[model samples]
Target: MSNDFYTSSILPYAAIIIKICRAYTNTQEDFEDYYQEVCLQIWRSNENFRGQSEWSTWIYRLTLNVCLTLLKKNSKHHVTSNHLPDVVAEDNRTFDDESLNHLYNAIKQLSEVDRAVILLYLEEKTYQEIAEIIGTNPNNIGVRVKRIKERLKKILDGKVN
Candidate 1:
């Protein structure tokens, strides 16, 4: 049943999971671990689907929540990894352009919440949709997006930490 569900539901939406997980993790091993964990949580919580939103929207909210929760939990116990990859997590195939690579690399440095906001914005989601997914007031999204973009610009220009 689970395998069937995965094939029918999750496989089709795997790219979103990969994008969210890759954004949340630094190393390839951590990316694999985060992806596995997000899939597990999605499976475990499948029964709670209330049909209140599009299946894709539910997946996005779940992916973001799982990534944020795991990031917070992991941050408390910091461990330096000698095997860390030189480049911060970017799916080379997805971002083949040199400039996109730099932009995405800069994105990875953003606060987790900002990264979530910008990711949704890049997906062309409306402020209302982003607010709904992130569980915030719609009015706040515009301001947050402006700030996030400015920060990304600074990061790209080597102007800010």
Candidate 2:
């Protein structure tokens, strides 16, 4: 990727990529790998974009697809572990907000498709936008978002086993 293009095209949209990668990954190392792969994939696949949608929307779909694909591949080769290790912060630092941590931990428990839906929802994407991205009906997106929200609330409240 050219430095200028990356700075202009990818850097501006990196937050969406990072958040999706973070939601799908349990550890920092895995997060870095997924993030790298997403960036590389976006660069490799940019030419295929036909400009039918906004750039941000295209990036969102690309990021989600890459993360989900890598996740599925990893699950097949690795034994599933119930416990996620504590994420060690760089320079021995920690995030300032506890609720954010709780939220992300809860988000991590959602099914892959639900995770993508909720992430897009949290990003304030419209139901139609989410539907377009996920290839579902707009009406279904509302119902799914409602259900996912309720499930997340239960998880946060310690009601869901």
Q: Total clashing residue pairs per candidate?
A: 0, 0
lDDT of 2 by residue, 1-161 (tens): 88987898899999889889988887778889999998899899999999999888999999999999999899999876433434532221213677777787778788989999999999999999999888889999999999999999998898976
Off by over 4 Å in 2: 81-95
Which model scores highest in lDDT?
Answer: 2
Question: Which ten contiguous residues of candidate 2 have the minimum total lDDT?
Answer: 86-95
Worst lDDT run of 10 residues, candidate 1, spans 80-89
The estimated TM-scores of all candidates read 0.87, 0.91
Against the true structure, what is every candidate's RMSD?
A: 3.3, 2.7
> What does candidate 1's lDDT look like per residue over 1-161, in tens digits?
37898998788889878888877777677778888888898899988989999888898899999999888888789873422244543443336688876776777788788888898898888999999898899999999999999988888787964
Q: Could you tell me the C-alpha RMSD of candidate 1 in Å? A: 3.3
Q: lDDT per prediction?
A: 0.81, 0.84
